[model samples]
Target chain A: MSAPVVDLPAYEQARRIRDGELTAVGLLQATLKRTEAVEGQQPSSRPYALDAADLEKVHAFINRTEARALQRAEAIDAALAAGEPTGPLAGVPLAVKDNFCVQGTATTAGSKILENFISPYAATAVERLEQAGAVVVGKVNLDEFTFGSSNESSAFLPPVGNPWNPAHVPGGSSGGSTAAVAAGEASLSLGSDTAGSIRQPAAFCGVVGMKPTYGRVSRYGLIAFASSLDCVGPVARNITDTALMMNVIAGPDRRDATAANLAVPDYLAQLDSDLEGMRIGLSPDYFWLKIFDPTTGVLEEQPISPEIEKAVLEAAELLAGRGATIVEDVPMPNTHMGIPVYFVISRVEAASNLHRYDGVKYGFRYGEDTGDLTELYRKSRGAGFGLQPKLRILMGMYVSAEQYEKGYYERALQARTLIRQDFERAFDPEGQYGLDCLLTATTPTTAFKIGAVYGDSVLMQYADMLTVAANHAGVPGISIPAGLDRGGLPIGIQLLGPDFSESRLLQIGRAYERATEDASWRSIRPIVVRNLP
Target chain B: MTKLSGLQSFMQGSGQKDPASKKTESCFDRRTASRYNDCPEGEEVLLPQYPSRQDDEITPEIFDHLVDLAAFHLEPEEREYLRKELNAQLKAIRELEALDVSPEVPITSHGVPFKAAISAPLREDVIEACPEADDIVAGAPETELRYIVVPDIPHEELE
Candidate 1:
């Protein structure tokens, strides 16, 4: 029999099954078989590439989840037949990033440190999605503790390759979520962004990733990196799926004191609303910053590629043509200070947060005979943590101590204050160019060669400069695949808005996506082969 | 006042000493005491008698007031360090006693700094399920499922 489907959204897949046009068992088996066949072939495609250990782990979950899937499917069918409660996402199968805890599943957060740890409860985001009848396939990979901008920082796996080019990186820490959505491993996925964790990867993998305003979504079950910066959102194949997932995840939760008590809006319904009077602040300041050293004085030292800028600028013009007011000179905050402040605060928090992981009451331990507790701690931490983790821990330790705390840590906090003030001042102004949202490049360039950044700390450091500020300031941001390079790799445009501004941002982003007439995102290919000898 | 710890006194002298005042101190002066009493014999020879910020303006009464104010927030180690720093400043000021001093010499303070507002939002106290603790533990080279086994500390090695 022919494979059950191709390029179908989650809601449509569920609808097909509801109408008896497709069987859940048949679809599941087809997916497993397709995954297996792809594995047997050992292909060099982007989306098809799956780590041996991770693939096995996810397959095991799939096997174990068969009964659960059947039970859920039958319930859905019964509901459809009996005219019972039917949610918009009823019976849809999905995957979620490992950063989110699902009860009965081991949420690894894509780190080896949490290898055997099982979350005792579900993340509020996951709980709501499941409550809406979405069947979670499994947890996806991510950067360790959501720290690095690239998935390569993961202690457990090499970075997820882009779905378009296996040789290129899937920008991360939400790489796995975006990859899953683009590759059709899941109809939709959930990911968290502290910096560009969600958007960067979404842009790289040619999918949609949303980071709702800082307090718009509850961060109850998501692990902390920089608490002030972190936000959880959805990744999906298109604008509608992204909205669907966002509707389920965004809301006030008592579990997270930071969660805003505002009423959740109908994100999907807001898509078609006219944005004729909306003002988008296009900061030329973003393009002027020296992200990378310039080879020539004539050309500004931009981290973004020329083609990528062309795509974004063209889109900006298109937005202007669509009756939106696009002003170019509007400046961003002290964006250059983002990296330093982010590093200090994030590392300081990381050091304190990871302190709980010392081989003790719970987790992996290290040490054999006759030594002190200090030695135990040193050895256990040394052994459990990866190099990046160690570097951050040391950096954080240095910043938190009495000596450097005054100069580095305190200064960073001061800078953060100035940056926040700058943002407030920019947004609070009235008239000609009152800011509804700020626009910028999601990533400086398209996905680069895999293992390319292995030895380059400068490149790695610059990887997050553009996106880190939004995280530091605790604002909402989203990334949509704007266009493609000659290599066919996708470029993303980032839209950052004030706190609690996701619904409007989504509406704006949806209009841009539809108006662009770009379909390079759909060209992303999943790994069709695995298990190479 | 509490006695300053050896480490505290050393740290205070190390950071707070003014180089300008060190040139005037006679090492042989009868009343000029050393802050390096805790230093090893060879190390004590290298200790410089740099001046403190204390003078007639920094009286014992003022010292007591500063100490009381600081006690609320200072850690024991910090208090000891601060006590030494205050004492050093007082001594340095008094070194000017032999010289014809003018009342017009302006005194400066430990500089107070301020930044813009908006403290970090406090994380919710509610405990949500995190990644499996055991999974994190599994990566340890030597660990029991929960606790990291360790060797006993020998008392002789205590610093």
Candidate 2:
């Protein structure tokens, strides 16, 4: 029999449907069945006891749009029959990170504050994807207000479990988006990366995720999450599929002023291109952690996991064999400061953005019996938001307070300048490094057990350390699964390139994918997908 | 009611089997030890700390002020936990102070500079009616006659 429809790469899925070998409806049915098999239950605001199955299955979705997906799938097939042009994606199954508004769908941002709000118009990214004939399978879960590095902060618990091994977290705040694709629930997903929301989770879940340069994709209908840092991109099972998704979503839109008003390139055009003569830099700074020593009140540097470091080095070796020159000891001194800088910049923006969620406008509201407007605002905001949002809002207020602005907000912005300059120097042809890209481990370690590092806000923020600098620099980064660690957990290697160079990043990732096509690790499926009937 | 450990028990009934070997107090408890337990065993780690800040955090009075300014009505326990976490996070944010950044360093408000060539020009100021205005107004928690309704304003006269 043809390889299980759900297990095929997205490009293959689209081609099969377009070639008349697979009907869009039939493919969507198979996808739904696979999703049902791996997805235990839709997470919710109502507390429910978790069971053995819930622990083992990937809880990737907050809302399943099966009926809507079926209708869209049938329409695509009907269009094909009538000789009408269907978009390039044809009938591929797709999931959207809930932060992105899908018209008529509840865009929760995984926060109870938005739990009841329904979007009247779709996000530009979602609109483009649907226009490309990708069926919207469902809206996936995420950290509340996209505020946490792990999905544990989502009010709708239990948060998304890593598909590779459900006991662990699927990194966040795009946890559900990556987990859904990894588990074969969807061929592809649209995810946003702000301080590594998409790339970090994609790494943990053993999927290919790209955060195109900021402004590469329009953020028109995406609920704001650190607006200056937020970026929408694709999560897929393979490099080619990621490129396919990027080809459709990466472009300018009038709705988003930040979007680059430039011609979009065909991401698929450069796949399989040689990395020959390309200079890829390796920075020692990416291989460790810098934290404050409580006693001295000074920063301390600690090295990363030897296994993860080995995976990145091995990826470099493999690329070297593919004709790429590896430059060593490239100093990204400011890399260690990404999370610290992000802590201030992101919260200030988050606090400002969330201010729009008052009781008077759309979204969750407090009791009608409130005595006055101020009381109504307090009750609604307190009742609607989960712990993470409250924490961010309070922190944002404290940092941006008149007395603290220069010490925190403006300083963080300047720190951001230094972070950006680090990339500029490394990528500058006139500079000593002159590197086209930098290769590093996507995260400090592989996926950690669910709840392992969730409660500690400080520890949780560090999860994005390796991936956030790219966000700070407005560069594109792709996380590709390199190999499995000793625990049989997937390890990801990241490739970060200069601004607006998503095509080059994808080309590099595609080279790695092609080089490791027959590698034993590539054959290993996620635990949730392994025994599915 | 003490603050949550960096590690937590599966109160959600995640059905995670108890480990053959459990550490003191909790399965993955390392608050006092370090917060990097997620790293491979024996991986040297240094978790962020701020002894002075922890001892003399601005959280007590400032935190309450912040909570009110943010307009949240947090429960006492929740407030305590949030306050502690916020203090811990602030300690971490304090790391930015180490950079010898000067006023001359141009602040990067957005990562990629929005050059005039690549940046979209401002949209013309036009009164384009939102086709979904009614839909949006109707989405409010409480609305009447296309206006979002709320409790009494409780205004006071200026001195």
Residue-level lDDT of model 1, residues B44-112, one tens digit each, is: 222223324342333445544533321122234433333443333223222122222233422211011
lDDT of each: 0.60, 0.83
- The positional error of residue A119 in candidate 1, measured at the CA in angstroms, is 1.6
Error of 2 at A116 (Å): 0.9
- Per-residue lDDT of A1-533 in model 2, one digit per residue for the tens? 34588879999989888889999999999988888888887799875444556668888999999999999999999999899999889999999999999999998999888998999999999999999999999999999988887687787876788988887889899999999999888999999999888888988899999999999999999999788999999999999999999989988899999999989999999898898889999999998667664446666676766778988898888899899999999999999889889889988988998888877788888865778999888888988988788888888888899999999999999999999999999999899999999999888777776645565677778788899999999999999998887666778899999988888889889888888889999878888877665
lDDT tens digits by residue: candidate 1, A16-91: 8777786555555554454443222221112222343332221212112445666766676677778777576776
- The interface root mean square deviation of candidate 2 comes to 6.0
Per-model DockQ: 0.04, 0.37
Assign candidate 1 its CAPRI class: incorrect
Give, for candidate 1 chain B, the lowest lDDT window spanning 10 residues.
Answer: B107-116
Q: What are the TM-scores, per candidate, against the unseen true structure?
A: 0.72, 0.93
Docking class of 2: acceptable
Return the top candidate by DockQ. 2
Q: Fraction of the real A/B interface contacts present in each candidate?
A: 0.07, 0.63
